[model samples]
Target: MKILLLGQHGQVSRELQLLLSQGHELIVLGREQLDLAETDNLRDAVRRLQPQLIINAAAHTAVDAAESEPEAAFAINATAPGVLAEEAAALDVPLIHYSTDYVFDGSKPTAYHEDDLPNPLGIYGRSKLAGEQAISAVGGKHLILRTSWVYSLHGRNFLLTMQRLLQEREQLSVVADQIGAPTWAGSIAAATVQLIERWQSAQTATWGVYHFTARGETAWFGFAEAIAAQLQAQGKTVAQLTPIATTQYPTPARRPLNSRLDCSRLERDWGVRLPDWHDGLLECLNASR
Candidate 1:
């Protein structure tokens, strides 16, 4: 299959490239090649690639920063996706996009299902939700997979941030109130490829939203503790982590209290299950080592 991938340098995009390149032809574009802010350039790139599948992993992912720069976030996250969907529909290609668990307000006590109503608490979530709406409105063949707490060995994410902090700081405080799965970018990318292949085989409907996240849930503080434990097991000094409430470490944007996503639908549909967060974390850490 011929696949056109945006956000070539992102963690998920890189993993998708690694997985899909083994059996498919992949054309990837970095920020310079196809900037989201420039809709014409993005559309032109898609037209030129003329791929069988268009995977949009590009997004303005700075959650707290989006609170201050909502306009820029919307341009890249919301508006750009609509443009991509329009182009994909015109070209009759399947569009695969990634959304976020932040779309929910995190008020639910249990894992969120695909049918849950979105009530984004901050600008970033609102922007992503807007993108989802735009794609659906276009009546295009698209799959929007929402995931949370994504980490990878090759990107600026929670895992890397925790590792860096442990190296420099003796003690750190992480919010314990916000809970979600610590998903690996590699896992999400692999699932995406599987979904694409399934759709190609006439299994999936080619239009719907699904959840793809790691199994199990943990607060930020607990995730950091797990990282510290892994480092300690590997003969590194473990950092002292302090658990704090979200209000104790206030950011420019508000996050959902529960970002957990139920992956039962994904499993039932694709026959694929996400690994446990600790296992994924260990694999990533070992790879980095």
Candidate 2:
């Protein structure tokens, strides 16, 4: 399969490059080759590549920074995805795009499902929700995967920040109120492969929206503690983890208190399920060494 992956250095993109390269003609494009903000250029590249499958791993992911850059966020997160969807539809190929759990307002007591109403709290979430709507409005064969708290050894994410902070600071305070699965980029990539394999093998693969994230849940403080635990086990002098409320460390962009998304629909429909967050963190940490 000639797969055109839209991101190169992103955490999930890096994992996809490694996983998808085994048996496919993978053509990866960084911002230099094809910038998402450049709508015309993005459309032209997709048309020219004419890949069998289109996987857009690129996104404007700076949550807090997005508040100040709404235009850039919408251009890349909302507009670019719609353009990709239109092109993919023209070619009659499946479009695989990643989304986020931030579409919800976190008022729900339990996990959010595909049918749940979206009430984004900030510019970043609103932009992502707009992107989802755009793709749906385009009416193409597309997979809108809504995951949360994506982290890996690469790129800027919670995992890397915590790892470095834990070693440098003797004391640290982490937000304990915000809860969600700290999904590993590798876990997301592995699940994406399952979705692709099912589609190619003529399996029952329905496209629309699905929550693809790691199992279980943990607050940011718990996630940090987990990272600290692993570092300490490695004979590193880790930071003394301290739990702090969200109000104590406010960000430019508001985040949902609960970002858990129910991924049962994905398992039932595509026969793919991710591992526990703890297990995934361990796997990712082990892989780094």
Candidate 3:
């Protein structure tokens, strides 16, 4: 299968490039090749590529920044996805897009399922939810995956932030109110590849939203502590980690109190189970070294 991936340099896109390169013909484009904000250009690029599969890993992901730049966020996260979906539908190709767990309001005590209603609290989540709606509105064959707490070694993410903090400070305060899976980009990429393979072979009409993330859940403070522990195990001195509530460390945007996602739908459909967060974190840390 020929696949065209947007956001080629992103953490998830880099891993997707690796995973899809082996068995499929993959063409990647960075922002230089195409600007997602330019709707016509994005549509033309997809049409030109004529790929069997279109994976949109591009998004405006700065949660706090989105608060001040709602329009910019909507342009990229909401409008661009709809454009891609419309183009893909016109070309009759399968569209695979990534969303966020922020689409939920975090009112539920348990992990969110695919069927759960979305009640985004901030501009970031609202924009992503709009993207999901756009994809659905296009009436195309699509898979919108919502994942949480994404981190990788290659880009600006939680892992890198934690590493920097570990080096620069002897003590740090992190929020313990938010809980979600710390998913590795590589794992998400691998699962995407598997899903593509299954879809191609089965030729089944599989479409709609699903959740994909590393197994298990942890608070941001706990996640930071784990990272510190892992660094210490690697013979690095760590600091005194302090857990604080969301109110203590206010950001531009209000994050969900709970970000856990239920993976049952993904598992039931694709038979892919992500590794635990700890294992994924270890792999990323090792790779970062």
How does each model score on TM-score? Answer: 0.96, 0.98, 0.96
lDDT of 3 by residue, 1-289 (tens): 7888989788899999877888778888888888899888887888888998899999899899999999999999999999989988988988999999999999999999989899999999999999999999997789999998989988798888998898689889999999999999988988888788788888455689989999998999989999999888879887789999999987889889999999988888778778899999888777766
Candidate 3 global TM-score: 0.96
Runs with alpha carbons beyond 4 Å of true place in candidate 2: none
Error of 2 at 216 (Å): 0.4
Q: Give the TM-score of candidate 2.
A: 0.98
Query: On residues 10-116, what C-alpha lDDT tens digit does candidate 1 reach at each position?
Result: 88998888888887898888897878999888888888879989999999999999999999999999999999999999999889999999999999999999999
Instruction: Provide the overall lDDT of each model, using Cα atoms, as 2-decimal numbers.
Output: 0.89, 0.94, 0.90
Pick by TM-score: which candidate is best? 2
lDDT of 2 by residue, 180-248 (tens): 999999999999999999999989768899999999999999999899988889899988888999999
* Candidate 3 residue spans exceeding 4 A from truth: 203-205
